[model samples]
Target: MYHRDRSPCSALAVSRSVERPRAAVLLLHGGHEYGTSAPGAWNLPAARMVPFERAVRRATKEHDVLIGRVRYRCRGWNGGRADAAHDAERALHELARVAGDVPTVLVGHSMGARAALRAAGGAHVRGVVGLAPWCPPEDSVRHLDGRHVVLLHGDRDRVTDPKASADFLARARAAGADASFVEMRGSGHAMLRRSAAWHELTTSAVTGLLGLTPLSSPFTGEGRLLSGA
Candidate 1:
């Protein structure tokens, strides 16, 4: 129930698009490498995000929304000038054009999660959902100010530091943004375990961010806060 669309003038790859939607969800996948120009295909992130994309679409089916999965042109981000971020910027612009100022939330993993946070300052973006994000200390934490950001990081994740996410949330709150960090237990970067928990957490966060539903309580665990009133 998704359409495969490619960016004619740019390297933005839309895995699929929805029709007559009420809202939009832009998905950013993880992983990037240098020598992207030497690639034979758009091998960045491969199809690792397909399952998540479908999960988003399925989760939001009742909400009547569009889910856009982006395959970036530049597959690298290390000392790479946020190439994926630039692609996400264009992808958001195109999404706004297609969806017309709809309430939008960015959902991304790792590298894509950082891009989502970077590009979330756009006019139509209302919130972001980052899954096991890989954020450097240099990544601007101010761009996420005043936007709803829900970070789902696995406590067992060895790929991205969960502590970084916690630190980012503290910074976001200090900047007066409505943010939350759900420290997922017993799950890794892939989030293969506790499937129901992941889906529910994601759906609830998306709906609550868009004001379609009441926000979940921040009273979750020790030494952590959801950073909202």
Candidate 2:
């Protein structure tokens, strides 16, 4: 058996499996990203998701974790009614049920970051990694209690405001969540310029959030710890 039921949300790509995963990580890609699907449609392993998917592969090899990469149903998440968020939510639910209640982490980029944070409050979600994340004013403090969140943004990012991520981290901590912010200097929203550094930061943060490793850098970088617990 492929061991999966095909649904719209079930299209997420599953990684190399461990018999009983210690945790599960879902990779959510950004909005306005092109995929093989039609406009206003969702597809897996989108162009923007490649880097994060590589990160997931690296992290899983080092740790006992399962991977889920979600494709959203739309190109935009405007006005707070987003099919992307719903798709992520459904993927998480489906992953949780199949994986047997393991710790769930959502690692997202850009608009996907917004969706991850929105879905973090849902059942089985353990933490969130927001890379160049788009943080809405309303979603900053929702259902964050007892969840861990990390925001990593590039200072040179013009697509998503790094300041907004910093501000949201502060608000999330104040509203009873363990949250932190990291600013990657000399980096861009695409994260391709410092691709190595971006991937390292995301993997290190996710492993640390899982309590499987300390928050130690694998490579030297110009990243600065803005604030955290």
- Which structure among the candidates has the greatest lDDT? 2
Q: Enumerate residue pairs that collide in model 1.
A: none
RMSD of every prediction = 3.8, 4.4
List candidate 1 segments past 4 Å from native: 1-4, 8-19, 33-46, 218-229
Per-residue lDDT of model 1, residues 1-229, tens digit only: 4455654555345554566767888888787544354223555464556666766666666776777766576566646577778879988887777777788888888888998988989998999998888777777777777788888888889988999998887887677667778888888888778766776777777777777678777523323564212
Candidate 1: what lDDT?
Answer: 0.74
Across residues 1-229, which tens digit of lDDT does each residue of candidate 2 receive? 1244536547465754567777888888887533334334434326667767777677768777888777565666756466678878878877877677888889999988988998899778878999899886667585888788888888889988998897887788777777878788888888877788778878887877777777564212222346221
In angstroms, give how far residue 198 of model 1 lies from its true place: 1.8
How far does residue 64 in candidate 1 sit from its true spot (Å)? 3.2
Q: Worst 10-residue stretch by lDDT in candidate 1? A: 220-229
TM-score, per-candidate, Cα-based: 0.84, 0.84
Q: After superposition, how far is residue 56 of candidate 1 from its true place, in Å?
A: 2.0
Would you give me the overall lDDT of model 2? 0.75
